[model samples]
Target: MKGVMRFGKKGKLSPRFIGPFDILERMGTLAYRVAFPSNLTEFHNVFHLSMMQKYMSNPSHVLNYEPLQLTPHLSFEEKPTQIRDMQEKRLRNKVIQMVKVKCMNHSKEEATWETATEMRSRYPELFGTF
Candidate 1:
């Protein structure tokens, strides 16, 4: 199986853990077979012990978990909840427009600055009239 790619950025800022997958069986010393959801069936089930983590059994955690609606490719779309701020930068003679958007499941620190053109195309509702 190929390595998993980082989301958004390419460095340590990327998420390291994806899930608390169920362990199906122990294979030899350092490897174990894990169960993956139907959407992630393309990925191999066997993984090294180093890659596995013991999920702390907590019923409260499950109760608070917000399960995202995943697409067929096991990815979910992040919808912009609100427009936090708008700014236009004057570079030389050109003006570049940018918008700070607050996305679902993300905090203020995680909110990203995206081009106004892209936001309009992807999420027209966010722009309202302008």
Candidate 2:
């Protein structure tokens, strides 16, 4: 997770919060040991409280998917799957056309706003001819 995770969307997408892992025991006043699954055994189990979040039981977390394909450096390209909407963004002395883009690996609620020209250029199929 070094540097900002650029999905290559050319946008400043925020970093993702990965887990709500089980806290096994308190290591000290500021740290706790967490239960790590076999796949994450390479990482240290103890972490500072500042680096962890409290686990809240959630019922909507049922679906599972395969791990994302990443390069040896651990990054992936974010491709727009569909253009959901379009509108004009008004700025002082200017108006910019924008597209509501639904990207792969994200839900409808996570769709983002991107410049229409950029989207059309990067994903011509979404725009067809012009």
Top model number, TM-score? 2
Tens-digit per-residue lDDT, 1-130, candidate 1: 1112223334322334556777889998999998877666766789889877777777677533344455556445566788888999789989989998876655677777878887788788988845
Q: After superposition, how far is residue 54 of candidate 1 from its true place, in Å?
A: 4.4
Model 2: what TM-score? Answer: 0.60
Candidate 2 Cα outliers beyond 4 Å, as residue runs = 1-11, 20-27, 32-46, 58-66, 90-95, 128-130
TM-score of 1: 0.58
97-117: candidate 2 lDDT, tens digit per residue: 999887766778888888988
Give the TM-scores of the predictions, in the order they appear.
0.58, 0.60
